[model samples]
Target: MRTADSAAEFQTAAQWQSWLSQGSTFPVFQPVLSLETQTVFGYECFGRLDLSENVASLGTFFRASDQTLNTLQQEVGFTLAQQVAQFFSPVKDARLIVNELPSHLTALTPLELPSTLEALQQAKFPLNRVVLDVLLEPGFQNPLRLKTVMERCHSLGCQVALGNLGSENSQLDLIPYLKPDFIKISLTLFHRSFRDRQFRRTLEQLGRLAENSGSALLIEGIETAEELQQALQLGARYVQGYYFSAPGRLPAPLPDFQKKLREALENFRMIRTKRIQRQVTWENEMLLRLVDISFVLFEADGLLRLNETDLEGLSGFIHRLYFSDLNGFQISGDYLLSETGCQIDYRDVGRNLSLRPYFFDHVYKLHGRPGGWSLSDVYCDENSRCLMRTFSRYVTPQAILYLDVLWANFADL
Candidate 1:
C-alpha cells in the first residue's frame, strides 16, 4: 500500500480522482473492546488503499482543495459503506463504525443518503448495526449544519459518533449540542491532560456529562497496559487501540483477549481498593492523634476559650479550629492558621452550623457517646481552596470541639 509520504507524486486533482475511482481501497477493522465485559463491542473500519509505501495512509490522498476533498470523501464513503456491508454482514452483535468527515456530510446538497442506504440494503447489512463516525474538524464551524448531518444519519437508523474529541481541531464545547452516541477521545490529548492534577476532576466531569447527555465515553488509542488501566479508572465505557489489536484486513476473535482483559481489570481494582484502604487507615490514625491532642488541651484548661496561642501549637497539622455547642452553634471564634502565624476570626463566633452535614448528620450520631469522635470524608474547603477533613469530638458536656485538618498534611502523615 502507498504511504502518505507519496502525496507529492499525486499533486493533480485528476490523478487523485482517478486513484479513488479505481475502488482500490479496502476496509481494515480494529476492535473496540468493552472494559467491563472484556469483549469486543464493535469494530472501527479504517479505509486502506492498495498503494505504494510513499502514500502512507488514505488521508493523504484526500487533502486537496475543499471541492476535491468533498468529491473524494463521497466516493470513499460509498466505497467504504459497500465494503463494510460485504465484510460485516454476518456479524450480528458487533457494530461497524465507518468514518465520515463532517464537511462531506454537510456539503451534500440534496443529501447522498439514498445511494448509501441502497448499497447497504443490496449488501444485506443492517442499518442498526452501522455507526456513522464523524471526525470533528476545524472546517466544521456551523453547529446547525452538523446537527442536520447528525439528524440525517439518525433518520437512516444508524448510530452517530463524534470522533477526535479533545484534539486540537475538536470542538469540545459542542459535545452537548452534538449529543453523539459515542465521544471518541484522542489518546494523545488524554495522555497530555492526564499529567495535570486537575485531569481526574476534568475526566470525572466529562464522564458525568456523557452520562447525562446519553453518550458513551470511548477512549481511543489505548496502546499500553497503563493507558488501559487509566482509561478504565476514569470510567471509559469503550476502549480502542493496539492494546487489544491493531487494524487488520479481517475481523476475528482475539486470542485470550477476554482473559487478559479480565486479569488486568482485576489487578487494577485490587490495587485501587488497597490504595483506598491505606488512605482510610492513615486518615483514621491522624484523626486519633488529633483527638488525643484535643483531649489533652481540654483537660489542661477545662472549657476555656481557645485563642491563637493555643491553636498555634497544632497549626502545622490543623488549618482551622473552633468550638461549637451541642446544638451545633459556634460558641468560640475561628482560629485559622496561615503561613505567617495563627489568626483569630471573631466574626464567625455566633454563627450556627447545625445545618451542616458534618455537624447535623456525622457528629450528631456521636453526641451522647463518651470518647467518640466523628471524622468526615475529604471535602473541598471553600474558604481556603484546599481539601479538608473535619474531626469533631465532644470536649465538654455542652460543647463540641471541631478541628479542620488539611488533607494534604494528613496525607503526608
Candidate 2:
C-alpha cells in the first residue's frame, strides 16, 4: 500500500498536460451509498482513462502526483466537469461528490470551490446534485479558506464534505467549525478500531460528534463484506467502496448496484438484529440475577447484621459485596462466599467511592428518586484482568449496595 506522501513524481507536469489534452481521460464514478435508505446517495468522481479493455485511476494519479500535475484540475477537472454534465440527469440521478483537486488544497492559493462551481455551472451540471469533497491534510492551516469554500458550496445548493478523516494525520478539530454536510472516513480506520481500544474510543466519539453536529458519516474503501458490516456498526449512513460498485466510466450502475445494496442491507439488518437480541437477553438475565441477590441482601437486613458466616450463601454468583453510604464512603465490609465460605473484609470500609462513575452517576441520576439499580461501564479487573462492571443499588436509605461480578460468567450465555 504505497501512500501519496511517499509518492514520487512519475510524470512531469508537461507530460500529464499533454496526455490529458488528447481528451482520452474522462471521469469515472464510484458510488457513495446511504445505508439507512439502502439507496445510492451519490457518486464520487475520479478521473479514468479508457486503456483498451484496461482502465487506470487518473484522480489517484494527480493526488499522488505530489510535485507534478498538481495543476491537473485547472485543465482536466474542468474538462470532465463539462463531460459529466452530459452523463447525469438532474433529478433522477443521485448526486456526485467531486474531490477538490490536490493543488487547490494549498494554504497559499484561494479555495478552488468557487472555480469548481463556476466550471460546473459553465458545463450545465446541476448545482443541487453536486457535493464538493474537501480533504483536510495533516496540518491544513487555512481555516478561513475552507470555511469560505464550504459557505460557497451551501449558497450554491451544493453540499460539502470533509474527506480523508480517521487517518492518523487527519485534521479532526476542523470538523466542528466547518460543519460540512458530511464527513468521510477511510476504511483503514474501521479496521484499526477493532484492535485498538483508544482508536475505538475515537471512532465512537466521531460517530457521536457526527450525530450531534448534523453531519452524515461516510466510510470509504469498503472492499469486503466484513468491512461493510463494520461501517454499518460504526453508524456510517453513507459508504463507498468496491463492495457495492467499482469505479468506472459511468452512466451509473443503478439497476445492478441497487440490487446489490438491497441484498447487502437485508443481510446486515438480519445479522445486526440477532446480535442486538443476544445482548438484550444477556442484560435481562443479569438484571434478574441482580434482583434475586438484592432480595437476599434485604433478608440480611441491608448487610448490617450480617456476619462473615452470613455471607456464605452468595458464593458462586456474587464475586464481592459491600456498601457505601449516602455521602459515598464505604460503610460495610465486603461480604462474599466461595470455596473459602464466609469472608468479610473491612480494610476498605472508609474508602471513598465518590469520584467513580458507579458512585457519582448513580447519585446524579437517582438523586431526587434514590431507587433503581445502575451498571457501570466495563473495565478490567486488576486481579483477574477480565472485563468487569459494577452493579449498584440502594438497599437502604443510607446504604448503597455494590456487587462485583465476573462479567464473562453472564456474558458467555
Q: Which candidate is the best by lDDT?
A: 1
TM-score of each: 0.75, 0.77
What are the per-residue Cα lDDT tens digits for candidate 1 across 75-95?
675776688787777766898
Off by over 4 Å in 2: 1-23, 50-54, 64-70, 89-91, 101-114, 193-202, 256-269, 292-360, 364-369, 377-387, 404-413
Off-target runs (Cα >4 Å) in candidate 1 are: 1-15, 18-23, 52-55, 60-65, 109-118, 289-306, 320-413
- lDDT at 289 for candidate 2? 65
Error of 2 at 129 (Å): 1.6
Against the true structure, what is every candidate's RMSD?
A: 5.7, 5.1
Please, what are the lDDT tens digits per residue for candidate 2 over residues 1-413?
11121113445676655554443767777888887777778888776765544554565555653455545645666777777776665437588788773236443244345455667898777788889888656656677766776676688799889887877677777788888899987557777986875566578779889888889998888887777777777788888887777776674555665666667778788887887788678768778766655344433433353445455566777788788888988877776557767677767768788866577877766666766777776666655566667878787877888887777675433
**lDDT against true structure, model 1:** 0.73
